[model samples]
Target: MSLDPAAVRAAFAAAVNMDAAELEEWLETPESLSVGQKKDGALESVGHAAGRRLVTLLRSDPGALDEDAYRLMRKAVGFIRRHRAQEPANMVTSRWRYALMNWGHDPLK
Candidate 1:
């Protein structure tokens, strides 16, 4: 399935309980933007990596995320991690899993 970059960004903003405009700045950072390459359809491949980073941010910082958003982010992260684990051979999933690990969260755990 193809992923829409806009929708992923929107959902990520909502998940963090941040205004889309404010979130745009964070998303534009070199690290975040570098998650995927545009030439390889990185939007679809790297969307989950971006989401993982956001979730990790919220997780490591206290009071940075509202209770509801925290719960939703956890659920989303868990779901994505689980899905990626189930499809170990898929390149997109493998990349996402590696990204999660690089960010300090192990998808297999």
Candidate 2:
């Protein structure tokens, strides 16, 4: 993703409304553990892993950010946007919401 750093930052901020504290807390939940794809019988889902990385990214100093960091942010923004568009009827407890939440997006918010 060769996105402009500023645009990626803005889009990411818009997509992931959950702050680091909120996302950190959410990531520890069983619901977070229960969703997303686990390729090749992996223990953790892709979104869950991304959430962990997102935590680190959220906590890092803005001045220290790099292209790789922006790339992850841009990718996350895309995932959140695409997933959000597929809003399920009962989002309160839907797996779709849970998956997005794992990626640091709380659709209900």
Candidate 3:
């Protein structure tokens, strides 16, 4: 099924209660953007890596991510990144923040 990028971005924003622009900025930095590589006229290596990391994190808990939740998160990250010109930092950061929160961690703390 095809996923809508805007919808994915909006869902991410709502889930994390963050400013989407802030996340977009963070995603374009040298660090994050640098991880991506050209592939089939698209830059998805970085996003795929990010999604896999999230999946791994959830999987490690053994019961954290059911099939549907895992699939949706993967789809959201992949679809949004694929459809955007500039990377979606807001969506990326929302995922990162969510992961950190899941582990009782904090970037600011």
TM-score, every prediction: 0.31, 0.94, 0.28
lDDT of 1 at 12: 42
lDDT per residue for candidate 3 within 32-89, as digits (tens), equals: 4444444777764545455444434433443454555545554554444434434336
User: Of the candidates shown, which would achieve the greatest TM-score relative to the real structure?
Assistant: 2
Off by over 4 Å in 2: none
lDDT value, residue 52 of candidate 2? 91
The all-Cα superposition gives candidate 2 an RMSD in Å to the true structure of 1.3
Return the candidate ranking by lDDT, descending.
2, 1, 3
- Per-residue lDDT of 1-109 in model 2, one digit per residue for the tens? 3668888889998898888889999999999999999989999999999999899999999879998889889889999989988988999999999999998898888
Q: Model 3: residues >4 Å from true position, as ranges?
A: 1-18, 41-74, 77-109
- List the global CA lDDT of all models: 0.46, 0.91, 0.44
2 or 3, greater by TM-score: 2
Report lDDT (Cα) of residue 106, candidate 1. Answer: 43
